[model samples]
Target: MLLNNLTKKFKHWLPLAKSKIEKGASQLENSINNYDPKEIIPSKLIERLNTKLNSLPVYESYYDTLTINVHDYIHQWIINKEQNRKNCLVIKGNCVDNLYNILTSIFSEKSSLSKETIELDYQIFSLENLKQNRRDRLNYLQEKILEIQQQSDKKIILIPDLSYYFSRTIEGLEVLEKLLKLLDEDENKFWIIGCNHWLWLFLVKIYHWDAYIENARDLPLLSQENLQDILLPVLDLVEFDWNDLRRFLVELPNQNEDDHKIISQLQAKYFENLANLSQGCLGTASQLCFYSLRYVKNEETELSNLKINNPQLPDFPSITQSDRYLLFCIGLHGHLNKSDLANILGDDQIYITSQIECLVNLNLIHFLDHQNIAINPLFYSKLTKDLKDNHFLVESD
Candidate 1:
């Protein structure tokens, strides 16, 4: 009886299995017959398309977007400073992108001034140079500024990253104070200082450095429209899969006038979400763009799934109080070498090496060069918030 039951089950399954195989073969035959040469897209072209989709869109500067107000504000500041005979104008922002945008606009060719007038008689002092005696570094910088003042009627001094030189030690603060004093005394020279936001806040609280500058401005957060303006130009570079875009638009109640217009609107919303996710930081937004598109190894699918979502914040591993302090110091300076970090931490190199390796492996921090290491920019905003919430850094208004 058991053998007969087994035989009955096999007989029932056999016909069903055969039917499925026959249907599959018929479909495969139809697919081959219907295949057209035009349907076959070159793999190279597909690869290029995926590359464009994965990459961050380039913008000349923050000015390219609708966020031109910051640019205009700086231009007006320059005009006012020149008219009032003000010597120093400080442009401070938490976002590195904003600070760079302001600096580039000042030096951009769009200026109406003559080539000679627009020329920047500027000198940049790197933090690496300050490894010498602090007193000597201060004196050398002062001497350079004075010499530049004498050479040209308009002297423009630029400190690309001022936070790099700031130190928790008394001597470091003194060097910064002396340098600022010297810059203040020179009424004929124009000083354009770019500082990271965290450092600027710390300076105001600890050193009262704000009193030395004639005027200071913070870059504003970009709006959604502003972000759209910045990203739209780059989207024009590639021909996206319209079928995919159309799938997203299937829910529209009415068929729009032209498919192109409807598709363009949907694309704008995609960019809008990207802008929101990045929280209006151009640098962060650019990095997120790169993270969203991923390549898959499935040969069956032409293009891998493009993930358009906010990147997940890195999960930091267990760290000691000392590790936290070191991270804050690096975040404050924007970047620092092992020697400088060790100096600030008042700890031995061996003590922190393992911790550094752990953080690097977790992608919380990375080496900017052979000697210098800095927090990853993608994690910067989240790290700052974490530090603030944990009462690591003093809260700033």
Candidate 2:
């Protein structure tokens, strides 16, 4: 397929895009020119707001809202714009209070209007808060939706926590379904749920079809196809260079050695695939591969197998889950025991333990006689060699 065809399709909408751009530009200039810091309603703040608003995607069918700063004044500014229009809604405040306020706001609005705003405080899902009680959150969300529907004929609903909700816990998944259920069934009521990257992944994992709905405006029938078209290209844009992969692995929270090893191996396989497929694409291919790698939850062992069978040495430093595991195993004094591994890693034990056992089965690590806990002398020797060679271990005696 010709790539330029896609560009042409985008170009077809240039006139509409131009007008939006001009309006954004005008807003930005006015905000910037009138800049002042002394007042609470300073132009400096508006300038910043304009900067963010200007960067919003020009695609007309989808309504875009900056999910930043749920600060009370900032949310009021958004709601104030909707007060002039009958169709928009704003839902805002602390999570529980936001739910209560959203209910009151929806009830207080004129039901005769074709549309109304429901601005939410979106912050109620702070990691600490959401993990506290999934059931309560889900119940509150369900009630909040009904409360809003009782008040207005709002078709399009904008929820900024799509990203936050999804990533914080599985509870967000319930929130997503409730939000969709709450929306009017009509074509005009497009639900724009803005979520961050990890939450986006959670959405992708559970409701792959819904991601398409997020962008669906025209024909409901082509939601999947349209979503695929939008996602693949955007996914193609997301990638991580080898160097970036290394840095990310290093910084992962409570990162374990086994995780490092696995991630490292996955990164290698991904780049290897990139080398074969990404001839003219360069960084773009690598970036897309990075996104794909992050979602390797489905075929992790297959990826690990790929790394072992066809090792792809990254040009720069990188760690994989396998690398981490290997390091952790290396930390053992004697031959590493499978039973010891199962006891320590507990809930987190990679489901691919059997496959890893295959490595031991292949004589990579020797099992002690009559005891399943011993590491092979040869394997430990190899680990020592690798650590010394890679400077992971310092020479002693």
List candidate 1 stretches off by more than 4 Å: 1-86, 95-105, 108-154, 164-171, 229-259, 297-320, 395-397
Best by lDDT: 1
User: How far in Å is the alpha carbon of 147 misplaced in model 2?
Assistant: 2.6
Where's the lowest-lDDT run of ten residues in candidate 2?
304-313
Write candidate 2's Cα lDDT for 274-312 as tens digits.
444333122223223322333221254543110011112
- What value of lDDT does candidate 1 attain over all alpha carbons? 0.57
Q: Report how far residue 386 has shifted in candidate 1, in Å.
A: 1.7
Q: Per-residue lDDT of 1-397 in model 1, one digit per residue for the tens?
A: 9999789767754644554455456546755875444334444544454355335433333433322433443355356554432565566666335354445444433352334435644444544556533345445555664666466455555665566455666667766776776666654466657787778777777767666664666555666676667655554554445335444443652474577776666666666666676677766665554444433334576555332332333443444455567788887766677876777777657556756765675556787658878777567677777777677867445
How many angstroms is residue 33 displaced in model 2 relative to the true structure, after the best TM-score fit? 50
